[model samples]
Target: MGKLAQLSGPVGLLLTAALTGTVGFLPQPAAAQSLLQQEGTLAPMQDTYSFEGEADQTLTITLTSSEFDPVLSLLDPDGEEIARNDDYASVLDSTIIITLPETGSYTVVATSFSGEGGSYAVEVHPTTEYEQVFDRAVQLFNSEDYTDSVEAFTAAIALDDSQPSVYLGRANAYLGAAYLALGENFAGPQSLEPEVRDAIATDYEQAAALLKEQGKPDLAASLEEQAQIFRLVEPEPAPLRPAEPPEEPANSQS
Candidate 1:
């Protein structure tokens, strides 16, 4: 199993979905299609819209109103608040980018920031291109193309750095590359360049930090231990050469 597959179940789903390139384009029943381009007036109060969303799917929800400052809130299937934003896009408008954690009913509340409602438009769309890149990264890593895997993981990170699993994948790719540089047994510390060593250490450290921030301290600890195994070992200094005898004043001696 690849390093990504070793992550917690929730995180494992993310990779599984990505590996299948099924984020934005997952097949769904006609009745469960995502909500799109809905507009109405909020009659001086909150207006809520409920819709079905798929797991590991990225959704872009945009709210625009001219009369009042718009506020948007997202709720999961259990009514747990996912995120809320006000004026994230422009004046009197709110935009939310959400990565759904599961496939179920979700609620979106659109209201005025000051509770003074007015005409508002809501648009929901999918953003899944990055997931494809993430999938490619996994494939490269599994294929043992460590250098290319690093690049692919980097591309995925550039698209979405919020995913802690991607950081773990990148860290492992860096470690793999470091081992490749050190030869078959990865024991040639003297031959390992400082930059290569630092790259490995830095990636693993980043992964650990991200994992900790994402509430996976145990996983972070495990990664930190792995990182220590590849810690840079400075090359021994060369023995000092014997000092050459001072040249006699040839002209004076002659």
Candidate 2:
């Protein structure tokens, strides 16, 4: 949501239902909407899916009856995890939310945490308005258009303020710009200036705020720790050069 938690009421309910697997009222509709593990639907001991996620995509996961160490993971074509969650509560299956960064095959793995048994539901689809903004932001970042890239990312976050990764990307961009500012001055062991230090701090702060909003306090704190460490040490001083004395006033006033 390039507008932040401003999603339509229905959309919010749909998302919550997908996340918690708590189907009620419109049982038929909910069952029809559930992509992964609808009741009675056979979920292969292992299940996988792929999608075109160039921009903003909403990938929903649902768990029916999970056991200890229940497993859920998403993989790119390169077999990299763009996002994943494997945690469980009281040996019950739990839905996890993850987003894709690029287009590729995504694998969703579900297994018992205790090496015994488990089941889950999953949904992978595009978040159009969200993806549009995300893609444009990525385009800007790759093109080295820092300001616009940041603006686009900001727009996306504003819509779904619950995403931690959005803030992470934006914060990284700000940190990159801050580091790039050193230029020729970038050489010193202590090369960073005070302004640069402050920029880094701000970047961490913004990112942490986003993570916190997403119900991830630990992650936010870790970023804060990172921001603090770099500020303590001063950058290396610039090298000094010898100076020559001024020449005698050109043969003084004739």
Q: What is the lDDT of residue 129 in candidate 2?
A: 59
lDDT of 2 by residue, 1-254 (tens): 01111112222122211122211110111212232333222233554544434434455554344223345566676877655554422124444445656665455555554455433344433334554565566557667677777788789777655444455556555544655665666653246666656665666667667657656576577766656654664445798887887888767675
Each prediction's whole-model lDDT (CA) = 0.62, 0.48
Q: What alpha-carbon RMSD in Å does predicted model 1 have with respect to the real structure?
A: 17.5
**Model 1 TM-score?**
0.40
Candidate 1 — which residues are off by over 4 angstroms? 1-127, 188-191, 232-254
Candidate 2 overall Cα lDDT vs. reference? 0.48
Model 2: CA > 4 A from native: 1-122, 180-184, 187-196, 213-215, 230-254
